[model samples]
Target: MHKEGDEIHIDEQEASGGSKEGVVRWVLAGGLILAVLLMSIVWIIPAMTQGDIEEEATVSGEISSMEGGDSTDSIVGIDGEPGDGGEVTQEDGIEVIEN
Candidate 1:
């Protein structure tokens, strides 16, 4: 019952609606992608790059000062001295060693 021109007009309106929907979907998808990218840069980038701060040596300073030295030997139980046995004795309210 419809003429050719009327059929063509209906098809045109449907195509226009489809095009609008496609554009809206594309915009939403693009916004989502942009938000994800920004969140990654803001929240994730710093966490990924974070590391423990280390001591930086000056060019003229001696490297030996940075290295842990013979001070560890001063610890009593660590040296495995006789009668140490992971025990500290209390004498005069202070720890004294029989070794």
Candidate 2:
């Protein structure tokens, strides 16, 4: 009869130890989930939702000089009023086109 009581007490102790380990496992899992959520909000989400860079040129009446480049330097210019005979000249690192 005494041995039966001892066995019951041992089983209870083992059950409580298992419960503590289960609680620790849950706490670690929750911490990892929270860290990932914060990282997404502070870094990943903003990086994914950023706007792309765009360049546009629009000419209405007359344009003096317009410059744009992606991997090289390029310039477009019209040096006088419309219908005025314009001279196109080439300079170092500049390109000119006559229309």
Could you give candidate 2's per-residue lDDT for residues 1-99 as a string of tens digits? 125644733566565665544788899999999999998789866655554321123242113223332423333336633565555668886755465
Runs with alpha carbons beyond 4 Å of true place in candidate 2: 1-9, 12-21, 45-67, 70-99
* TM-score of predicted structure 2: 0.34
Clashes of 1: 0
**Top lDDT: which candidate number?**
1
Q: In candidate 1, list every pair of residues with a backbone clash.
A: none
**lDDT tens digits by residue: candidate 1, 1-99:** 235854633566565665544788899999999999999899777766654342224332335444647554365675446677765578889766544
TM-score per prediction, in order, is: 0.33, 0.34
Off by over 4 Å in 1: 1-21, 49-99
